[model samples]
Target chain A: MPGLEDLYREIILDHYRNPRNRGELESPPALRAEGFNPLCGDEVVIYLAMGGDVITDLKIAGQGCSISQSSASMMSAAVKGKTLAQARSTIRAFRAMMSLHGQALDGHGDGASGGGGTGAVGPEEDERTGAEVAAAEGVSLGDLEALQGVVKFPVRIKCATLSWHTLAQALDEAEKGAGPD
Target chain B: MALNDFGPPLDVARIKKDFPILDRVVHGKRLVYLDSASSAQKPLPVLDAMQRYYETTHANVHRGVYQIAQEATELYEGARAKVAAFIGAAAPAEVVFTKNATEAVNLVAYTWGRANLGTTDAMVTSEIEHHANFVPWLQLHQEKGTELRFLPLGEDGTLDLDQLDQLLDGAKLLAVTAASNVLGTLPPVRLLADAAHAAGALVLVDGAQYVPHLPTDVREMGADFVAFTGHKMLGPTGIGALWGRRELLESMPPFLTGGEMIRDVRLDGFTTNDVPWKFEAGTPPIAEAVGLGAAVDYLNGLGMSAVRAHEQALTAYAMRALKERYGDDISIHGPPPGSERAGIVSFAYKDVHAHDLSQVLDQAGVCVRAGHHCAKPLMRRLGVTATARASFSVYNDEADVDVLVDAIGQADALFG
Candidate 1:
């Protein structure tokens, strides 16, 4: 019963119109990874400039739907200038929020619903807000919480997660190619 | 039905009553399905035929000496004959039933292609073919080391046949689509067939998109092999057919060798069955074949010429509507309104991504396909990552096009 208003929030639309860190970083200094959602032909390229366990800079390039582009923009803005551990935790928390893995993230057995979600949370629905999920993972979502509405539409979940997956790929590759520190 | 430039127009309102799914409501709006190119909605007769076959004559075909088994075999074989007649095949034995059109293309590639082609041989196809036709030949090139050549696409979304003679030269086989699934470009199959013939090569036409909307005659088109599927033509998903010349089919070895495909099993080897059954390996999609037979009957009743004409008129109306409403804001890819294109209308509205456009259209119960359409090569040729395609069928009319245009406008308003 979720409407388009819930999926395409003003914040998401604004982020899509003006993407953050929208360019390419030189490959010699920065690691690049690409992700593709073959279903919708959504491609996300993540460029990460790492300075010894800290992500000094991040840039995104590609084309896709509003959900994907906005998610990529929000992700770039959230993770930039953060430590490697902080970025990884943010990635995990954001994935958990988007996938509605509330039960696993919360760890507590009780079904206490988290507050702060602006949309209608029916009694039958999974009521854990993105903030609560992030809090459980010991990280905050900030503006990326706008993408939590994508959970209502399962198909767009891939679109939202595509950039994050590519970022993770960039991190993994960067670490692998790094020398003894 | 009255005569028009396209042909005798179809009675869409009357035909719409035949498909039960046409009455469905989505998002509190009446369903306006324009993804018929991806898969057409099944009519009542096709559904009834499938259910009736399962309820009354449920048995494995080409097996058992009992009366019911014989009846089952008759129905299954009868379905093959109907499919052959639908496409104007020379004989029923020339049509080999496979899982779907993809499987049919692979069968030809593995059997006829692998057997005849080699490292020196060159196989010519087009840039506009679906992955089903493209990948099989690519695989052939990879394994057999055969040279692969593509007929380039022109700027106007048609194949650049000016290079046809050069590409066809020294080629052993030419595999091409009868219609481009993404661009709605109807390639000149007869012309291509003749050119390939003069080049001393065989022709395989991917008729998956063509057969459903247009009147298909394998012989008239001069095709040695024509591949089409049931699902896209209002039949069930599991059944499809490849109609080849009987001599060509008989000459090729069995692609999948097992029980039904063999005449007799020996200790060392087995003799294969005759022509079509020689390629049909195991338990076939019997009920689906029966449904396909019923679909053929339904189309025949409506007439294929009428179906083609209906889609042509609808495509023309949709083109005019979109241009008139959007003007410089919308870009439609493919041949112009009258250039013998199929009913597929792939468009990019304003700056809206195809996925976003489709999502908004989904709210209004307008189902369209938004993606590379399994034609990434063609997408690249068209200089786009994806496009929102609205295809028409016998059941769709002008009202459907109107709804589609309005929904597209809604997308533009929201995105803008």
Candidate 2:
């Protein structure tokens, strides 16, 4: 009950139903990145338009479960119109949340935070990338907090984080003057 | 499902008692495990076999002359014999052990595929394969330029065998799954084998899903290679077998070269060991093999026909119950009820993504796999990204089906 209530929040379902910034951006001028949750075959492709330090525009495209699609939808909204540094901070915070070793990062201090994430059994715990994402440069997870419920279901965390991780990889690639292939 | 209802008198409660994990509680309710297509729950006999082997006969096999070592060697080879007999193989020598069915496929991909197949020759497989059969061919096609062809799948999840001959033209091998893990569709293996033989091509059956549920006779199936895993058949993980024709195996080169697989190693070159051992390089899974033998014994005791009958009834029950309950809200894939199929039932509930559906199910202690079920190309073919799969085993009863139906209703209510 602790994790499920938050996991499938109404807002998250709404985002999944009608994702924001959904689609592909034209290439070259707009760099593209891709991510996949091999466990569920959830794929997320993000296109970034970087104008100076700010993200001018971004678009997300792929098929996946509610946590992933909604997370991508929420992620696209969170990063768009934000500076590259702020977006990068949010990625770090998200990864921290999904990290395996418990209490590694502050869990944004919600009421459910006291007894959050019962943790899925066996060999899969290591696969949970951001178990309890603690911090970011005050990027404020905001709508992304709906995904905090994914912590209890360790495997689904990968689904929730695919786009953000892909965005991080894209940003890193952008710095190297190479777009994600 | 109330134990007194109309169903098979298969002593499911006793069967469930065999698996220790069946008693586990998830989310404060009895765990109704429905992910047997992914992996089956090992029974106490299998567990005890491995435990006993580790405690008593723990030694490096094939190297030592000591008592415990001999016992260990006997156990490891004994598993091969048991597995061969279970699948109705000609000889134990035909069974080559690997890590899992995936590794078994890789073994063939590296050894047989690399040696015999090339650019000019083609390989035909189905889209319904669990990447084990699909990816290797794709890799062969890409890296070695082997012409790759797929057996077109029907909308009902059966193979479109009409294209078999055209696809098998000039093909050296036809790889296919005996049963689709996702859709629960049982392909006509013997028929496909005949088609492949007509085209002068060898057939490899990925029996990972089939061998566990069905009465598998490799010779009767008429396939050259039958690959399956121990874990999926109620044994421990890290043990799978590739039952190949002795002539083909002897002809093929070794996939993994090392200690046990070789007869003699010189500075210049090395001579390989016997057929199965030649393929099984290094130290094999000793205790795991013993466990596999016990699992085989367990299956033999149950009788494969009875096991198949029980699961078929359960599958048919699930189909009728789900349709009766959800109607058009749920769409079950695979051949309709009464058609030849196995235990797996993969379905989609309207717009509720499989992950979300499974999550709600999980809350009610119903365990099911929610994804492409490792057949992504098939998933694409079916026009869905993911599906919730409920697979049955020998232990599952009408009670389990009742729990699953209730859980689905809960998910539907939540999403609604």
Best by DockQ: 2
lDDT of 2 by residue, B34-99 (tens): 999998999999999999988888999999999999999999998899999999999999999999
Cα displacement (angstroms), candidate 1, residue B75, comes to: 0.8
Span of ten consecutive residues with least summed lDDT in model 1 chain B: B1-10
Where does candidate 2 chain B have its weakest 10-residue lDDT segment? B1-10
> How much lDDT does each candidate structure score?
0.87, 0.84
Candidate 2 chain A minimal-lDDT segment of 10 residues:
A104-113
What pairs collide in candidate 1? none
- Compute the lDDT of residue B113 as modeled in candidate 2: 95
Output the TM-score of candidate 2.
0.90
TM-score of 1: 0.94
Candidate 1 docks at the CAPRI level of acceptable
